[model samples]
Target: MICFFLFTGCEQVSKSIKDTFQPKVDTIAVEKQQIPDPVPYDAAVERQIEDAQRLVETVLEKHTKAHVQYIEGKNTDFLTNEKKLNRAEEALKKLPQYLGKEIFIYSSIHFYNEGKIRVMLQHPQNPEYIDNYVYENETWSDPEQLSVKDNIRSRLISLQKISFTNVAKAASVYNEKIKQIEGAEPITGIYISVWDNNLRWSPASINGSRERYSIELNQNGTLKKFERE
Candidate 1:
């Protein structure tokens, strides 16, 4: 499911970028060349996956720097830049396979602010989630209620279990509880969900509403950091 969310709806995005960027170039002497045929879905998915990985690496570096600046209580515009968003969309266009594939790997950044980086990820077919935040105060939140030390441990265990069966069971029970809880705020943050093809990265339903999980990062290019639980 996580894989589907990350890989689907990319073709439309790529086409939009091509259309938006095509008009800005000098055309006086340039002859129109035949654009190559669109690549196969598999190929496009692979390219997008690579790009997303690269973006993660870049964010990791910048996030590390942002951590320090945030600690010093200094102003930094590390996370709100347009270039990073552009790069993120560009990378999303190249992701090939979803996380439930034999070698599915998931990593994403949803938002960055107040010296906090929110990360959402699922490894392979693992059902357990890694949802957490790193704050400028060097504090962290296990949004999933996972302990830092046991986070990956649970994920590793999930990979060996039967798919969806257990998750579905959990969801059935959780959903009932969700319905009973009442609140005006919409459930907007990430949680476990069955939205993707393989039931990966299942974001929980909030206030009877399901939300897409987001990973946020904060940095100033000099100090980097992150949080995953």
Candidate 2:
């Protein structure tokens, strides 16, 4: 009987050791089976991509010429001046590859005073791609890779509002003071110009003369400088 008991205890200890040392086999092979194979490149898609690239390049060249003409003071028609830019934007938007992509082309004439403009094309979905060009001094700069900020137009509108409001308030006070003087005119309107990230407001008087008020506004629409002429 003692031998049998010892034998039973040894058997239980061996079972426990084996259980502890045994490697667990994963029963769920679904994940391994679900791994997808790499997608093969399609010739049709490659052809489309090549066509789109050529279209974009052509549009960019045309846009550069139009901008150069404007900066050289040869084209004063606002609609004619923006025709190439509009065409470029339309062509880019129509590209199938650009669909559902965070692709944008932003053109701004206010970046420089000599009628110069900057065009920035960004594909945030593909960080490796960017095309930025500046047209100044009758030439287009080399393409540059630069990150484009979102909501640029909205920010500019906000800055314009802040600049106009401050200038209008100052002009009102000046008008009131001049009203006490004989035959003095009040400010009738304000024109806002944006250059070098600064807002300039020119207050127009009833007599047709104007004085400029230069202001700098922060990104959050706070006033950095409020100088009135």
lDDT of candidate 1 at residue 111, scale 0 to 100: 33
Collision count for each candidate, in order: 36, 0
* lDDT per residue as tens, model 1, 1-229: 8777666667778878988987565564354454566666786557655754554454456445543333233323323434443444333223352323432222433333233334444522345544333333333343332222222322222222222123223333334444555542322222222122223332322332333222221111111221222
Against the reference, the lDDT scores of all candidates come to 0.36, 0.44
Candidate achieving the largest lDDT: 2
lDDT of 2: 0.44
Once fitted onto the true fold, the runs of candidate 1 whose alpha carbons sit more than 4 angstroms away are: 1-75, 89-110, 113-117, 129-229
lDDT for each residue of candidate 2 in 1-229, tens digit (9 for 90 to 100): 9999999999999999988899455556766777888799897757755655554454456454334332334333222234433333344444565555655443222232233445454444664355666555445556666443333332132222232124334444445544544554433323344334444534322222344444443432234454544
lDDT of 2 at 141: 59
TM-score of 1: 0.20
